[model samples]
Target: MGRNTRKRRTPLAAKVVAGAAALAVGGGGLVWANFHASAHEEGPAHHRTRSAAAQVATIDCPDVGQQLSGVPDRARGEVDGELATMDSQITEAYQRLATTRRAQAGDPRFVQNTILGPLKDRRKAIIDRIQLEIDRAGGRADDNLDQLAGCQGRPAEQPQNGDGQDGGGQDGDQNQDDNGNGAAGPVADDFIDINDVQPNSRASENGLAANGDGGSTGTFTTDCGVNENNLFNSDNLIAAPGVDNGAHHVHDYVGNQDNDAFSSDEDLANADTSCRNQGDRSTYYWPVLRLQDGTEEFDANELGGGAEGNVGRILKPAQAELKFVGNQQGDVVAMPKFLRIITGDAKSFTNGDANANSSWSCTGFEDRQVTDKYPLCPEGSQVVRTSNFQSCWDGQNIDSANHRDHMAFVQEDGGCPNGFQAIPQLQVRLVYDIPTPTVENGQVRNPYAVDSFPEQLHKPITDHNDFINVMDEDLMNEVVDCINSGEDCQ
Candidate 1:
C-alpha cells in the first residue's frame, strides 16, 4: 500500500532563523556568540550562517535527534527505532485533543485541565525520561533544551491556510482553509452535543405513559443476578483466552457461567447461571455505569491515553419492559445458543440520532423525558436510563454480518416479521443517585460526573445491552408457559 504524505510546507526561513537567533542569544550566548562573532569577522561568514541555518532547520520540536544524542552508542539504534514511532503517537494525541477541545468548547477549564494538561504532562515526561537516559550514558543534554522547552509551553499550531484558500471567501468555498488543508467540518448535533439535543418529541409532547394492559400476552420477565464486574476491573470475562479485555469496556453479566466470545452450544448448555431460575442460563449484559464521586473507582484512564477508560456513574432506567414479541399463539421457544443480540446503537449518542427506544428520566418524574440532557434528580430521587433490544431472530443464523442482521425490532403492531422467529426480549435498566451540575468555583460542574466515562462516549444515554440465549429446554418451556398464561411473572 502506498503511504499518503501531506505536502511539506517550508516555514519562512527568515522568521525561523530570527527566532533561533533570539533564543540562542538569550541563553547565555554560548553558541550564538561563536556563530555570530565568527560570521562577522571571518571571510567564510556567509558559509557559517548557512551552516547555522541548516542546523536550526534540523531542530524539530520534541527533537528526536537531540533526545537520541544522549543515549549510549550501543543503545542508540534501539532508541532511534522507538523514536520513529513517536510521530504517529503525537499525531494521534493531537487528533484526540482536537476532538476533546471541540466537544468541551463551552468548558475552557475542562479542555485545559482535563484534556490538554494531561497531554502536556505526558510529553514532558517522555522528554524527561530521554534526558535521564542521556545523563546515565554520561552525555550532556541537548544545547537546544531551552528552545524545545519553549515549544512545549505553546499549544499545537492550527494550520492557518488550508488548501491555499480563505475559509470565508466570497464564493462561500468553506471546505478548505488558506493553507489548502481540509477543514474540520461541522460539529455533531446529537444528545452528546450538550448544547443542541432536546427531549424526544414522542416522549416530551405525549408523555411516555406506561403501556396499559394491551398486547400483554407472550411476555415473561426475570430478575437477572447483578454482579460488579466492571470493564476496567480484571474480573470481567475475556473475549478469548489470550486477549486481555478484548471487549474494551466492562459489563455486568448474568447467567451462563461459561459465557464468553469462545463459548459453544455445549459450553452454554452445561454452564450454571446467576439468574433466579437455574434452567434459564441465558447470558445478558451491558456496560457498567460508574458513579463519578471523585473516587479511584470512577477515575477515567487519563494516564493511559485512550477513549475506553471513561469515568462516570451509571444511572438506572425509569421503566423497563421484557417480553417475547412473536408467535401470537403464545408458544415461547428456547433461543438458539451462541445467539448474539445487541440493543441501542452506540454510535447514535454522538451521531445526531439518539434512538427513541432508549430513554432517560428521573425516578419520580417518569412522565418527563430527559434524553438530551442530564436531569437534576430531587433530594430523594434518582436518574435512570433504559435499553430495549430487538427480539425477532432469524432462526437459521446465530450471528450476522453486522451483529444485527440476524435479529430485528418487532413490527409496529408488536409482531415478528416472517422468517424471523420470536425470542425472549431483554430489557436493561440502570439507576444513579448523582445530582445535577452546580456552580463550583465559578465553573459549571456536573456533580454526578465526578470521574466520567470516556469523553468520546458522550453520555450515559448511549447505554446498550447484549445477550446470548442459552436456556435449557425445560426452562424455555416454563418461560413460554408463563408468557402464554397472560401472567406477569418475575
Candidate 2:
C-alpha cells in the first residue's frame, strides 16, 4: 500500500517538479541521465538569436512511467479490444505483403524492397504501431472486446485487462469505480475510457466537471449550443466548450490537403484567386485545433487515443507541435514557426529548458510580422511540443491558469503591458526529467519494477518504481514556478 501510494504520486510529483524548476546541470548525477541540456542565449540579431525557456517554465522530456500506472478511464475494455484490432491490422498488412510476394514469387522486380522495406519507409505506420507503448504506456482499442465469433482478440490477451473489467480473470485494481464513488465490488483499470483519465484507472486524480473522462455519452455545453453529436465523446462537456471565456485556442487548421477541415470546397474552388497561403493557394488545408481540443482531451496522443467514430473527425494532438506549412510568398518558399520569447529581470536569460528553446523579456510578445523572426530561428535553439500547456491551465483564469508555464510570444501576442521582448541573453536550465530521489544504476538492482505485478506486465522505463528520492518540494517548486515569469531566470 505504501509503495502503491508512492508510485501513484511519483509521476505527478515529477510533473510538478518538472514544470516548477527543472534546469540542465553541468555535472552528472541522476539529473544528467534524463535531461537533454542546451547552452543557448537570446540575442538581438533575430536571425542569429535564440529562444530560451522563459515566462513560464516548461519540460519537454517527460517521465510519466509513474503517473501511467493505471489504465485509461476513457475506454475501459477498449485496450483489449484495441490490441486485438491492431493485431488484425498488422495481420492484414502482412497478408498484403505476402500476396504481393506470391504474385511475383520469382521476379526480381517483385523483390523491390527487403524485409524492413514497408517498415522503414512508413515511419508513420511504424510509429503508429508502437506509439501506445512509447508515449504513456497507453494502448488504443484493438476492438476484440465485443467482437463476434471468427473475429480475433488481443494477441497478448492482455492490453486492457489490467483493470479486471473484461473478466479475463485478471486482478481487480480499482479501489473506486468510474464515478468517483466506491463500487459495489472490486474493479480493474479501464473502468472508464476518457482520454483525460489514465487508462486502466478507476480513480480520478485530475479535476474534471464529470467522471466519464468526457465520454461520448452526456450532454456537454458549448457556446455553440447543445452538442448532442458527441464530438470528442466528452460525456458531459460540449465540444469546444468555454471558447467564450477565451479558453478557445487554435489547435490546428484542417484543410483539403493536410489541413483540409478549414476551408470548404468553396474556398478551394474560387475563380480569381492568384495570391495566398495554403488555402489561398487553393490546394491544401489550414485547419487548426481549438484550444479546448489541444489540451484536456487531445484527439491524437502518444497512446493513439482520443476521438471516436470513423468519420472525417478532426483530432487534437496531445502535445503542442511544430507545424511547418510550406508557403509561397512574393518570391520565396518558407515555413512559419511561432517562436518562444524571454521574460526575466533585464534578461540574463535562463537556459533553454526541458530540452526546449527558451525566450526572455517578453520582447516579441506582441508582433504580427514574423518575417524577421525566421532564418536561424529553427536551428538557433530547440523545439518543444507544447500540447501539455493546454491541460496545465486552470481555464477559469487566463492570467493565473497554469501561469507557472512561460507564455509564448504567440499566446501572449499583445497584452504586454508588463513589458516583454526577445533579446540577446543566455538561457540556463536544470537537467530535464531527472527522477526525484534520483536513482542510480545499482541502487535497487532490479529497481525498475513497482512490484512483481507491473514488471510482469511490462518492463519499467526508469530505474525503479516509486523510488524518486531527489524530489524535494522547494527544489521542485523552484523549477516549475520559475519559467517565463519575467523574474531572475538564471
Candidate 3:
C-alpha cells in the first residue's frame, strides 16, 4: 500500500469528556479553553488526559537574525557564525533552566537573575562582535542590536485543577528530564485528537488558483528516497554556514549528499544526489521526527541529541514526496541555480505564528489540519507533515541577508509582488507510522515530537523545511517547460 493511502480504522463512537480545561494555542496566541465536552480516544492505550502543569516553559528573546539587513557579502559568514553562537548560548541557558526546578522554587527570580541575566550579557558581547564585523567590512551595522539581547521566561501551561502549582512534582534537584519525559515539552496538552478538529477549507492549491488558460497548471515530481542513505546532520548551511551543529537538532536530508556547514555552491553542484534524476541535485531536508520512548538512537549521546535535550528514537518517514508545481497566474520561470528557500519559521514557538506554516494531519483525515498541536491519529492511521515553499523570487539575488526577503509568498490574488518573478513552488509531504501516544495523569508517554531548538520545547509549531535548488540549467529549463505546458512530468 502507498504510504498516504493507509487502511482506515473502523469508526468508533466518538468519546466526549465534559468539564475539561485544556490549553489551546491558535494562530494569534495561546488560549485557555474550558469546554463542556471535548473529543478524545476510547481505548486502553490511548486516553486524552489533562496536560501537566506547565514547567519552566521556554525562553523568549528577539530574533537578531531577522533584524539584520543590508549586510555586506564580505562579513556575512562571520555574522552568521556569531548568530549560531547566540543560538548555542540560548540552548545552554535552556538546559540549565530545565534542570534547575529546585532553585526556581526557592527563588522566584532565579531564572531572571541567574539565567536570563547572564544570557543577556553573553548575547550582548556576541552582538557587538557582529556589529564590528559589519563595520570592518565597510558596511553600516545596526547600533540598537544590543537592545535585543535580553530574554524573558514564558510560563508553561497552568494546572487544570486550579491548584496554581507547578506540575511534575519534583524536589531537590530531581528535576524533569530533557527528553519527551515531562520537562522539555510535547506534554499531553501539546496533542489533540484529530477527530475533534472540524474540517476546515483551505485554498485549493495553497493559494494558487489554477484557473484560466493564463496560469501554469503543471507539476514535476522527483523521486528522492527518504534519506535511506542516512544523510543526517545538525548543520544548516543556509542559516549558519561554516558553523557546526547550527540547527541544534538533527535533520533528515534527501537530495544533496554533500550538504554540511562547509558546503560551497561548486561542491553541491558536483556532489552526488539521491534523486533518481541525476540532473536534479537539489537538496530537500527537514528536522527528523522522534518517538520520545527512551530508546537510544545513534545520536543519543551526541551534541544535538541527548546532550542537547533532543533524546528519543528517531523515526524515518515512510514516504517523502517532493513535487514542484507551477504558478497560478502565469508561466513559471526557471529558478536560478542554488536558489535557497526556507518554508516555515523554525522558532515559531517563541517567535509567534507570523511565519509559521506547519500543516499536520492524518492519512484518513486530510481535510482537517493543525498547526501548533500534534495530531493524535486513530488506529490504522499514519501521521503526515506538509510544507509549501514561497514561490516568488526577487529576480536577482539568490539569497538575502535575513534569508527571507529575497522571496515572497504569492499574494492573495495569485500574483507576485512588484519586481518579483513567479517560480515553481515546492511542496513536501512526509508520512510516518508512529504509535499513538498514551496520555494519563497529565503526562505524555512515548510521545512523538519534531526535533527543534532546545528552547523551542520541540513544539510542533516550530516544524519547518529547507530546500536548495541545485538543478543544472538544462534540467531547470525542462521543468519550466513541462510546468508551463500543463503536463505532469516525472
Candidate 4:
C-alpha cells in the first residue's frame, strides 16, 4: 500500500476527547455531525472558499427497479438484465459527471443538456424494455415506469467547519475538488470521532412488551471463517440475477462457494460450504471495506474496482460474526430453502434512507452507532459494521418481485406485522483493524470506506448485506428447536 508522506498530527484520542461534546449520535448508532456548530473554527482558508462555491457532486436518479413490481416469473431474468443495464447507465453518467466539472463550470446547463438528458433517454429505453418483458410475459407493467427515467444533478454537500481534529469537521470535498482525489465522495464531513457520539438505543432493543416474554430467546450461531478464501465478485444474484458486475462494487463472500450472478438454486444447493456445519450451506456476503491509501488491488482496473471509483486496499475483517437470533414475540419458523433476503438498500445514497439499515461504530464505543457517517475510532480502537436482517417472513414466497415484499422487520411493538411470520433474524457483525485516518492541511489521507455504486460515492448509508438461506431442512429445524428451547447452540 502507498501512503502520502505527510507529517502526522497528535494522536486521534486527544482530538476525540476534545470534540466529544459537540457531536450528536443518530439512528443505528452512527453520529451525524452538526455542520454549523461542530465544524472546527480554525480550518484552512481554502475550506471556506470551496464551501462557498458548490458544484455538482453526484447524479441522483430514482431506482427504476424498486418501482416495478409483480413481474411474471418468466420475465424476471430479462427484467433483471434490463435493470442492471440501467445501473450501468447511471454509473456511466456519474463518471462523466465527475470528469466534466470544467465543462459544467463553463456552461450552466451542460449537465442538463449533455449528461442528464442522454442518461434519461438511455434509462427510458431500458425501462421500456423492462416493461415489454413484463407485458410480453403476461404481466401488467406499472404505468409510472416512464416517470422514473429523469434524473437530477445534486450539488456537493458543503462541510461546515467544526470544533474537532483536522479531519473531524471541515469543508466537504465531495465533488471533484483536489482534496477529494476524484473519488466523488467520502469527504472530511463523512466521518466523525466515535468518542464524540452519544450512546443511543437501537429501535429493536426497545418496547418489547407487545410481543410478550421475549419468545425464542435462544440463539443459533454459525462459525463461518472470515472469507479467508478471498471470494470476491460484483455479482448480485438476488437483485440482478445472471448479470455480471451487477453490484458495480466488489463484495466479500462467505458460506456457499458457488454463489454468483449465474448461480441457480441447484448450483447453490450442491456448492461447498465455508461454515463449520456441513448442513448450513447458506450464502452470506457484504461489501468489502477498503483503505483509500493509493494501494492498487488486484481489481484496480476492473469494472467493480478502480473503474467504478472503488479504489483502495481491500481490508479483510478481523472478525465476521454470523448469528441467528429469535424474534421478540414467539419462536421462529424455519426459513424455506433458497430464501433470498436483502437487508439494506445498496443505492440508499441517491434513493434516500427509507430502507437504510447500516450501522457503523468503534470497538470501544459500541453503544454509540451512526447510520450515515463512518466512525473515526480513537487509537487502539477498531472499526465495526453491523447489519440486522429482516426477521419476518411472508410464509409463502421465498422471493418477491421487488425482493423486499417477502420479508420485513419487526414493528415498534416487537411483533411481526399482520400475516408475516416470525423467522430467525440473521445478524452480521464485522470488525476491522484499520489504521486511524489522519487529516493534514485539511485533507483526509488513508480514509477507509465501504465499496459502493459509482454514483453513491462510497457513502456509509449505502452499506448493505445479502443472504440466501440454503440450509437443509434438518439444519433449519435444529436451529428453530435450539431457539425455541432457549439454548444457544453452534
What is candidate 4's local distance difference test score? 0.73
Q: Residue 42 deviation, candidate 3, in Å?
A: 31
Worst 10 residues of 1 by lDDT: 30-39
* Clash totals in order: 34, 116, 0, 14
lDDT of 1 by residue, 104-160 (tens): 333435434653455455555555655666566666655454333322212211221
Candidate 1 residue spans exceeding 4 A from truth: 1-218, 228-243, 257-266, 298-308, 312-333, 350-356, 439-455
- After superposition, the stretches of candidate 2 with alpha carbons farther than 4 Å from their true spots are 1-77, 80-95, 98-472, 488-490
* 1-490 per-residue lDDT for model 3 (tens digits): 0011112211011000001101111121111111111111122321222322333456788899989998888888778778887887777676666545546656767777898999899899989999999999999999999899999766544432242233322232222332235326677777889998778744433423222356998889999998999998888888878777788889999989998877888878889999999998899999999887767678755556655656678899999999888777899999998898887888887787778886889999988888878999999999999988889999998888889999998887788899999998888989999999987766668889999886787789889999999999998998999899999999
TM-score winner between candidates 2 and 4: 4
TM-score of each: 0.52, 0.18, 0.85, 0.84
Each model's lDDT comes to 0.41, 0.19, 0.73, 0.73
Deviation from native of the Cα of residue 403 in model 2, angstroms: 21
- Model 2, span 146-235: residue lDDT tens: 211121111111112131222110122222111111111001211111222223331211111111221111121101111122222211
Residue-level lDDT for 443 in candidate 1: 27
Candidate 4 Cα outliers beyond 4 Å, as residue runs: 1-54, 159-182, 201-213, 440-442
